[model samples]
Target: MTQFAAEMIGTFFIILLGNGVVANVVLNGTKGNNGGWIVITTGWALAVFVGVVIAAPFSGAHLNPAVTLALAMAQKFSWAKVPLFILAQFTGAMLGAVAVWLVYKDHFLKTPDKGLKSAAFFTSPAIRNNSSNFFSEVLGTFVLIFVIFYFTNAEMGNDKTPIGLGSLGAIPVAFLVWAIGLSLGGTTGYAINPARDLGPRIMHALLPINGKGSSEWNYSWIPVAGPLVGSALAALLYLWLRI
Candidate 1:
């Protein structure tokens, strides 16, 4: 239960801050309106840092269900706990999206572009290329989870808790996310966490956000399926390398 709450809280902040940046940048009249990609990515990176720091002690900060699934596949985490962790992450993400919606309710009203409003809650492909978009997510998450496997290894997090990266500190994991965002995120906004994208997306569908656009359900499966596939691949490689 402690672990569950930890992940839930961590994911809540993840969406609140991560999506909050999008709302600020894209929504009309916000101070951060038109802040650009760097601002959004940077905000998400910092959000991860803070959230990981908060959840590390109790849950190892597997705020993303993809990470949880990958860890279990690599034999670092137990299968029994995967469902619980994923549920917590999704619940937390939904609550966080709700917070973002409420916080930016006025902004949503001020902003007339429904696409911008939807962007604040979910990821969409810049080009709408099915193969390329799915590939982008797969490649991005492979880097994320593969590198994550190395973070808590023999030397980096040495003498720290061996469970996960934050055992060393949250900064490295944060920096890892920052690097991924800066490098590979251009393709699909790097929806590396299924819960992060899907949970908020579901909220967008259910919420009464005056003019929120299509949830893009047709492309929805990419973010979820791609991350899971990529994480699984990362786990397989981790095992193959015996690292």
Candidate 2:
């Protein structure tokens, strides 16, 4: 398959599994309805694993716009490829959100809490404030991408790494995601990746679902903008500190 196809498929599963867990946790009632933070973090880590495994050989399985941009800034990835990768990632994320809606349609109708419904599709804060929420997102992505840069440099030189983690990297990354969520996600739901939050959010607005409220456009920019800034900074810092 071509790079676009690989990227689309990779990003599809990333958001599908990532947002799927949120839906399972926050929807009216289900097995994972009350699964809590641990579930969400583990699901996201597994989602990354799945997408990376599938797209690693063909396209490196970015599945994240911030990641694409940060790598481009580092000169490891071509600027020309960044747009196509982001497009594919967004498309895949939208498809994933649609799947989540279909699977949770009945529960969505059952849930009267608009926040819960929105939480399943995107993110909302336990405590909503502009500066704090935005800073949290930036810090989260900075840490996440900093670690990513470390791993990429450690394993794959300056460019993006191939995704086959051989079941070894899985536990560690999952644990790290778990730590991030357990420690930091409470305030703002840890939307450290732009695509992870925004794509599903767009779908939340577009999809015909019950109890869906305003897309929370007011706070939407934080996740996207903060992560980009954070990831870019992290990449630069990593280059200076580690390289």
Give the candidate number with the greatest TM-score: 1
What is the alpha-carbon RMSD of candidate 2 to the true structure?
2.6
- Tell me the lDDT of model 2 at 185: 82
Q: Mind giving the per-residue lDDT tens digits that candidate 1 earns over 131-219?
A: 99999999889988888775456123222343454554688878888889899999899999999999999999999999787999999
Give each model's whole-structure lDDT.
0.88, 0.78
Candidate 2 positional error at 105, Å: 0.7
Model 1 per-residue lDDT at 167: 54
Model 2 lDDT per residue over 97-129, tens place: 899888889999989988888987787777888
For model 2, state the Cα shift of residue 148 in Å. 1.9
How many pairs of residues in model 1 come into backbone collision?
A: 0
Tell me model 1's lDDT, rounded to 2 decimals: 0.88
RMSD (Å) of each candidate, 1 decimal: 2.2, 2.6
Error of 2 at 146 (Å): 1.1
The candidate scoring highest on lDDT is 1
Clashing residue pairs in candidate 2 (N, C-alpha, C atoms within 3 angstroms): none
